[model samples]
Structure formats: C-alpha cells, structure tokens
Target: MMTDLVTSQPAMRRLRLSPTLSKYIARQYLSWFCSFFFAIVAIIYLATIVDLLDRLATKDVSLGITLNMAFLKLPYLSQEVMPFTILFAAMATFWRLTRSHELVVARAAGVSVWQFLLPVLASSVVLGALAVCALNPLSSVLLSRYERLEANYVRNQASMLAVSETGLWLRQADESGQSVIHAESIKPGSVALQQVMVFRYAEQDRFVDRIDAREAQLQSGRWLLFDAWLARPGVPSEFHEQLALPTDLTADNIQDSFAPPETISFWNLPGFISLMQAAGFSATPHRLQFHRLLALPMLFAAMVLLAATFSLRPQRRGRVGVVILAGMLTGFLLYFLSNFVFAIGLSGTIPVVLAAWAPAGVSLMLGVAMLLHLEDG
Candidate 1:
C-alpha cells in the first residue's frame, strides 16, 4: 500500500506539473514575444513616418497619407525582425525563470530540460509558420498597395513593369515621347525578347508607329530586331529580316526595372517563379526568397534553441550580464552572416537553398551540440 501510494503521488505530481509547466512557459514566452514585436513595430513605424514626412513634406502628400503609408509598411517590417523577436523573447523568458530560481527548482525536481523548453520551442515553430502563411501574404499585399500609392501620388511615376502568365510589359521614355514594349517571353541574362511588339510615340505624345518582331535583342545602343514588321499611320507596313531600333535603355535599366521579389506573396511565388522561368528570365531572386521564407519556421525554432543554450543556465554559474551580452552578440553575428550569404545567393555565387538555410542549420547544430554537452557529457 505504501509503495503504491508513493508511486501514485509522484505520478500525479508529474501529471500536474507537465501541463502547468507548459502553460507557464508558453505564457511567459508569448508575453515577451508580443512585448518585443510591438516595440519593434513601433520603432519601425516611427522611423518610417519621419522619413516620409521629410521626403513628402513638399510633395503634396498629406499627413493622413503619410501616416497610412507608415502603417501599411509595418506588417512587412515586422517580418524582418521576427527572428530577433524570438531570440529576445526566449532569452527573456529563460532569464526570468533563472533569476527567480524557478528553472533551478524545475531542474532539481526532475523536469528534463526538453520538457520545459518544449512550449517555447513549439511557440517558435507556430509563429514562424504564421509569419510565412499569414503575415507574409498580408504584408505583400499591403506593400504593393503602398508602392502604388507612393508612385502615383508622391513620385508621379508610372508602374515600372507588369508581368503575367501572358507576357511582360515594360514602359520607358526618352527624347522620343515614350514606348510600350510587350514580349511573350525573355531569354535569361540577356535583354532578348521573343514575339515582341513595340508601340512608339513621337514628340508631343503622337502615335508615330508600331513595330512587331519575332525576336529582339538589346545591344550597346539599340535594339537588334529580327524578322521585323514596321507599320506607320499612313505608310504601308514593311517587313525586314533585321532592323536597328535606337534606344537609351540598357540591360541594367531593364533588369533594375522589374518589381522586387519582396512584393510577391508566398502563395504567388511558385507561380511567379514558373512564369519567370518559362519566360526565360532568371528567377534566382524569387527562388531565394521562396527558400528563405520556407526555412523561416526552422530558423525561428533554431533561434529559440540558441537562446536556451545561452540563457538556460543558472545565473550563479556565471556573470548574468556577460552571458546575456555574449548571447546577443552571437545573435548579431548570425544576422549579418545570414545577410552576407543571402547576398551571395542573390549573386549566384551559391545555391539559393543553401544560402537561405545555412544560418538556421548552423544555429540548430550549435544549440544541439551545447545541449548535449551540458546534459550528457
């Protein structure tokens, strides 16, 4: 009877603490996360407003519009700092538990490290998924709208480029009034357009002529059109095997003119990448972005693991301030390293998948190594 009672008591105690501990840790982590997230959002919003006010002050942009732009940008900015938020949240949660001697008590009472860390880790995973699946789409939409509003009202400019399953449309102006070019597709890394149509305008925005070409390649100072058809207002259309269309536009300008990959939603990226690829445009940027977002959940979980590695130890074991500073420094290094590798990926120096995932992979391994050493070695 005594053995049964004793075992029953311990089992019941574990059953009680399991859920309670998870709830406590989850709540603590969430509190810190929200506090950190909102604080960062507020910081970004304020900074955005200041820049807007400075740039748009004399551009006929109203105070309301400026505030709206700032607010619209917050969602996208929030994503940029999410990993940091997770890191700070984990550190704060563990630090508080350690300072209050709660963690020490839990460890002494036979609570395994993973047992207490599970809630925070799970939270990190969920938050990362939500960031990709929910926040990302919302941010992408709002950012597009914001860019449109900024271009129309503040910049007084036309949309740079429009791409779809059908084709690509580009608009540019020079000493000659303007031109709208449509192409069924493009050849990657070169300004070579297939099934191209160019609508030309003369000075005073007069409809001057139209040229249709089976193919066109942009060279030093002019477009080399192949199998071209030239049509004019009153003159008969003429066909030629080759033609030179003078232009001020360059490969750099055309490449720079595409909408940044950041503006595309996660759900739309795969389709967009396909379209770009079929159109013979390099989709490296979009591919990199897609991989980066896909890796985000794992990266966030790694952040939590790394934080726990640095902050879970009792403060009495080391100088608390120094330990925290070291942890933060490590986080900073990770951030810069991620940026550096991502840039390399963008430049095609390495595979996009590797660039996007390397930081998270390294962080996860480092954390697991530290935990093994602490718990088992």
Candidate 2:
C-alpha cells in the first residue's frame, strides 16, 4: 500500500504541467509559428508583386501604386495560408523538440503526451482567437481597398450595384452618358426587376429624360421595359407598351457586381447576412464564411493534434521520411476536402452550418483518433 501511494504521487505530479515547463513549451511553439508566418508572408508578397507588375506592364501604373496594392492584398492571402502555416509550425516545433531530447526528458519524467501538448494546444487556440477577432477585420478592410484599386486601375470598372433597405440601385456608363436604375424588388435568381425607374443623364451630368417601367428584364445587351412612360426635357411625355433601352450590361456583369464574402469582416458578417436576406438575396456564402471563422480555433487545435501524431515518436523509430511525407499528404487532403465542402455549401446543397463546421470537426476527430492509437497502443 505504501509503495502504491509513493508511485501515485509521482504520477499525479507528471499529470499536471508545472508553470516553468508550460511557458517553455509555449514559447518554443510561438517562436516557430511566428518565424514560419513571416517567411511564408514574404514569399507570398514577392510572388504577388511580380504577378501584379506583369499584369500592369501595359497600363500607366506607377511602382508606388503597385507596391501599395500588393501590401494591401497581403493580409487576405495570409489568412488563406494560415491553416497550413499552423500545421507546418506545429510539426516543426514538435520535431525539433523531440530531436533535441527535450520532449524525451519530459517523457522520462513520466509526463504523458497530453500533458506536454497542453501548452501548444492552448497557444494555438489563442492565436486562432486573435486571427478571427483582430486579423480578420484588418484583412477584410485591406482586401476591399485592394479590390477597389484593382477595379479602377486594372479593370476600369465602376461601382455598378448597391442594395439597401430602400431597394437596389444600378449605374451603367457609355459614350452617350450614364443611366441610373432603381428597382423596388428583384427576382431572387434572375436579372428581372419590378417597379423600375431609370434616370438618364447626358454628358456633363445634364438630365435628359426619365423612364418609369412596370418591369425591366436584362437580355442580350439591352433592358426590355414593359408598360413604360418616358418624359423628356422640353418635350411632351410619351407612353409605350414596350421599350428597349440600349445597355452594355449583361446578367453576368450584374451578378458579378455583388460584394463577395471575403470583403466583409467577421464582426460585420451577421449584419451583412441579415441585410442581404432582407434585400431578398440568398445569404448562403456570407453565413458560411461567418461560421468558418467561428470554427477556426478548433481547426487550429486539430492541427496541433495532427502534428503531434506525426512528430512525437522517438528518434529511434524508423521510417521518419515516410511519416513526414504522409503527414504532408494528410494536410493536403484535408485542405482539398475543406474546399470541396465549402463549394457544396456555396451551392446551397447542404446547410451552411454543416458545411462550414464539418471539415474542422472531421479533422479534430481524425487527429484525436490518430493520437490515441499512437500514444496508447
């Protein structure tokens, strides 16, 4: 009985992380993470700058503007690569610690794998929280600015569509001038507008005429208006059963004009989703993005678990190269799975909640199972 009590005391001590050990492990993990982050970000920035310069070679854009656009675009690309960064960082941290015999020392002291992993898991969760709360908003703002710059300097597209509590507004420009269109309601999946009004302006912003139409349909580079009444300056009003207005706009252009999900911040996503739904448009993409941000912390933790499975084995174990190759393959597979599921969500084939959460949830479970098999078996 006394021998058992003595053994249990040491085991209990091994189960808990001492303050010094926790800090040491956490610092090691964070150092690796920050190093990998900066390295990856630098690589992405350089590649993007090269691509942008190539694309803008024909345009009269200056180096300053190109650099500014690249800098603004960095945060969004960073967010996209963050998951892989975490995976690589955690793997490198564990592998280095094991190689240096630090984790071996802890194991020799009877510390379990889970006990030593606690610090890394906790740190990943904190990083994920910071990413979602602070980094995401900054990324969204910078990405939006980059898009605006690209539109103006690269694509030469004006802001074409906007939705509000009042209704939808559209503007199109041509050699003649510009026309502003308003519609009280739009069909959910088509370019059909009801209760439409069109205001035409000639060069120098001179008002030319106004047209009120019961319905407007965009077809083949023209707006086909039904039951339309046109009023011209210094002329009598005219009524027409059907009228065709020439436009360079098409269904594809109008659809592409909507703001993409990545342009919205995490804090603003819920409100944006609400506004989009209220405007009678499907909010699936925004809702999916919101839920994805919410699930990022769990995903980070899952990455830690997966890294541990591949890297925690002793150096004496053979097949190190095979194990690393397998780990990388697993990460790639998970990434493809995530993108596929997100595509499914965007298509509205599955619930937004399920599609957003499934990849992370599946990764967490797979990691846990792998760790259990490795550590316990």
Candidate 3:
C-alpha cells in the first residue's frame, strides 16, 4: 500500500506545471505557429494574385482590382490551410526543443511528457477557438466580397439570387435586358414559386412593366406565370390567365446561385439554417459548417497530439527525415479522410455530426494511443 502511494505521488507531481514554465512553453509554440502561418499565407497570396491576373488577362480589369480580389480571398484560403499550419508548427516546435535537449533536461528532472505538453495543447485550443470565433467571420466576409468581385470583373455577371426570411429574390439578365423575381415561398425540391412578383426593365434601365402572379414555374428558358396581372407605365393594366416570360435562368442555375456555405459567417449559420429550412430549402451544408466550426478546437488539439508523437524524440535518433515524412503523410491522409467524409455528409449518407467530428475524434484517439505506447509501455 505504501509503495503504491509513493508511485502515485510521482505521477501526481508529473501532472503539474509551474505558471512560468507553462507560459514559456506556450510562447515558444505560438511563435513558431505565427511564423509558419504568415509564411504559408504569403505564399498562397502570391499564388492567388498570379492566378487572378491570368484569369483577367483577356479582360480590361485593372491590376489594383486583381490585387484587391486576392487580398479578400486570402483569409478564406488561410482558414482552409490552418490545420496543416498548426500541425507543422507543433512539429517544428517539438523537434527543435528535442534537438536542443530542453525537453530532455525536463524529462531528467521528472517532468513527464504530459506535463510539458500541457502548455502547447492549451495554446492550440486557444488558437483554434480564436480561429473559429474571430477568423472565421472575417474570412467569410472577405470571401463574400471576393466572390462579388470575381463575378463582376472576371465573370462579367452579377449575383443572381438571394434568400432570406422574407422570401427568395432572383434576377435574370440577357441581351433583352433584365427581370427581377420575388417569391414568398417555394415548393420543396422544385422551382415552383407561390405569391410571385416580376419586375421587368428595358435596355438602359428603363422601367417596362410589373406582373403579379398567383403561381410561377420555371421551365426550360422561361417563367410560366398563372393568373397574372400585368401593369405597364402609362398604359392600362391587363389580366391574363397564363403568361410566359423569357429568362436566361434555369432550375440548375437557380440551385447554383445560392451562396456557398463557406461564405457564411459561423455566427450567422444557425439563423441562415433556420431561414433556409423555413423557406423549404435544404440546410444540410450550413449545418455541416456549424458542426465543423464547433469541432475546430478539438481538431487543433488532436493535431498537436499527432505532432508530438512524431517529433518528441532525441536528435541522436537519426530517423528525423522519416519521422517528418510520416507526419506529413499522416496529415495528408487525415485531410483526405475529412474531405471524403464531408462529401458523404453533404450527400446525406452520414449524419452531419459524425462526418464533422469523426476525423478529429479518430485522430485524437490514435494520438493518445501512440503516446501511451511510447511513454508507458
């Protein structure tokens, strides 16, 4: 009994860390994280600028606008690669410390691996939280602007659709001019609308006519309005049992016109989901995004754990290259797994929660298992 108690005391001591030591270790990890993060983002920004310039080569867009587009897109791109940044940053931090024998000295002093890792893990959690809460909204806003710029300058088209609690708004434009359509409600899984209004405009933005309809259906290249009343300026209103309006919009176009889930801020997702569902549209993508944001901190912690397993070794081990390669491969594998699972979730083949959380949960468990094998076995 006495022997057991003595052994437990050492384990308890190993679990504790001094505030100063914790702060130092956390600072070191964050320093490396910021360095790698900015370096990677800079490279991505340059690449994006080049790509934009190429896309606008045939267009008359100014270089300033092209640069602006890239800048707006950079935050979203950073979000996409953040997990890898954390993983590589963690790996570099641990590898450097191990090579410097700082961790080695701590281990000799009876500071267990878990004790020193606490600070890094905590830092990662905080970083992940900040990314989700702060960076995500910023990224979403910038990405939305980037899309608008791309549509206006690169694609030479304006946004065609918007959905909200009030209803759905759609705009179609062609050589004939433009029409704006509004519907208070939409039929589930179809392009049929109820309580519709269409506003027509002629060339040079001249007001042409307005139509109010009880129902409207989008067919191949036109909208068929039933029981519609047409009113034109300086002319008598007319009632029609049926009317057809030419449109460049199709059902597929309407579906594609929705704001991509990535462009919606995390804070706005829940309300957006509610709006979509209330409007009889699928909210699966937004739901998935919300869950993914909720799981980000856990994912970051898992990354740190995985990085530790690969890098917390002595410099004399002589397997540094192999370890680094293996770590990178593992990171890539996890990324692929996440994408594949997200696809399945988006297709409704798996629950959103499972698809969003599984990769991080699995990676975390694997990291914990490996750490146990190395430290205790």
Candidate 4:
C-alpha cells in the first residue's frame, strides 16, 4: 500500500498541472489574438476612413455620425479577419515558446506536441463559436443601422425593397413623383413581376392614380405592362392592353436591392430565407451565409492546426523568417480560394453547402496531413 501511494503521487501531480498549463496557454493565445485583431482593425479603419471623410465633407452628416458608422462597421469586419488572427496568434505563441525552449522542457517532461496543442485548438474553436453565436447578431443589427444611416444621410435614398407574406414591395422616386410597386411574386435573375400594382404619388404626397396589371417587364428606363387598368379617385378606371411607365431603375439595381446577407442576424436568417423564397426571390446568399456561420468554429480550429504545423517545431535562426512568411502566404491563399469558391457558389455553379464548408474542410485536411508528415514521418 505504501509503494502504490508513492507511485500514484507523481501522476496525480501531473494531472493537476495539466489543467493549469491548459489555462495558461489559452490565456496567452487569447491575449495575442486580441492584440492582432485590434491591430488589423485599426489598419482597416485608417484605410477606409479617408474615403468616408471625403464623402462626408460633401454631405450634411456630422463627424460624430461618420465615426459612429466606422465603429458600427468594425464588428462585421472583425468576423472576416478572425481566422487570420487565430493563425497569427497561434504561430506567434508557439514560436515564442519553442524559441525559449519551453516546449523542449515540456517534451522532456513527457508532454507531447498533441497535448499542448489540444488547448490552443480548443480555445480557437470556442472563440469561433462565440463569434458566430453571440457576436454575429450584434454585428448584424449594428450594420443594418449603419446602412440605414448611410442611405438616409449620406446617399439621400429610401427603402428600395421589402418582403412580406403577401408579396414583394418596391419603391422608386423621380423628380415627377414617387411610385410604390407591388408584386405577388418575382422571377429571379429577371426584371419581371406578375400580378403587379402601382400606386403613384405626386410631388405634394397626394395620391395621383393607381395602375394594376397582369404582368410587368422592367426594361431600359421604363416598365412595360400587359393588360393594365388605370384608376383615378374621381374617374372611372380605364383598361389598356399595353402601357409603359418611365423608370430610372434597371435590372441590376432591382436585383441588388434586397437586404444583403450581412445585415440579417444569424437568429433571424432562417425566417428571412423562408420569407424571401416565399416571395419568389433567390435566397441563395442568405442560405450560404447561414451555412458558413455554422461551419466557422471548425474553420477556426483548423487554423490552429495549421498555425501549429508551421511554428510548433524549433525555430532555426536563418529559416525562421522564411517559414513565417510561407505560413502567412498559405493563409492568404486559403482565404482567396474560399472567396473564389464562394463566388462560384453564388453564381449557382456549385452547391451552397459545398461552398460554405469547403474552406474549413480543406484547411483541416491540409493541416492534418502536414502535421502527420512532420510528427509521424
């Protein structure tokens, strides 16, 4: 009994130290991550604020409002740079530890590479999950508000499109008057609407007339209606087989008018997707965004693996710079590839799920393969 107790004491002490070590590593990683993240955000803000400042000079918006837009947009931009932050932070952490021979000491103490890396990977995954589940909703709401302010104050525009259970609604304004257009359904990729109603309002906001049509086709600078009914408050409605209404809107403008995927919170996306589909608009972008958010944590975890694969080993004096640069370039390539595939998916050349998951899947696999080659080969 005395011998058994003596042997187990070392193992028990090691077990207790393991959690302490994990916490320490996670704290270091998170600190470095926040440092890199804010650094990048600051750089982006400086780059963008110049143009915003110029635009604001020509508008009535105050400097405070412009700064608010910049701050409001920061969260959404943070989500984009998070994976890079993880990669850089992990690489820096492991490189520092390895350079200082801490990892060598740990290995001599029987701690394997896998054991230390486990905590870093877990931390990255947790960060990714928090970004998607918590940060995303907050960013979306603020981004939507920023866009509204930009439209109202900076660009002098109003709401362009809306979706409801009954149908799709659109609004347009010109020097003559404003028009509200409604359609029971819309045909994606084309500027055509079915079962259309148009309400015309004069310069003083007086109701001028209403037009109903079985179908309307948006063409260059005009809308062509088939079987139209024109009605005025004091006159009997007149029916026409064909009528053309002047418009400043084009097909591209109409298609670009929907609430962009970034503005809708993750919690609200599924309902928005259903509503958009029901209203006969392509909900592909929203679906793609939701799937991407679903896959984000795994993506960030994969970044940890890749970072470790590059920096976990001992750093050689002459080769260290090259290795870090190569790792950064690799991350850049992965980002570009993900974007290319996403664009393809948006164009309907591939499935949305494939586009959304491919970046993380490929990163995870590549990282695993490299780690295997280094550790086991």
Candidate 4 residues lying further than 4 Å off, grouped into runs, are: 1-17, 152-156
Clashes in model 4: which pairs?
A: none
Tell me the lDDT of model 2 at 249.
92
Q: Could you tell me how far off, in angstroms, the CA of residue 148 lies in candidate 1 after the best superposition?
A: 3.1
What lDDT score is found at residue 88 in candidate 4? 97
Error of 1 at 106 (Å): 1.7
TM-score of 1: 0.91
* Count of steric clashes across candidates, in order: 0, 0, 0, 0
Q: Write the per-residue lDDT of candidate 3 for residues 57-151, one digit (tens) a residue.
A: 99998889999999999999999899999999999999999988888988886788888999999999999999999999999999999999889
Candidate number that wins on TM-score, 1 or 4: 1
Q: Per-residue lDDT of 186-208 in model 2, one digit per residue for the tens?
A: 77887788899999999999999
Stronger candidate by TM-score (1 vs 2): 2
TM-score of each: 0.91, 0.93, 0.93, 0.90
- What candidate 2 gets wrong by more than 4 Å, as runs, is 1-7, 233-241, 316-319
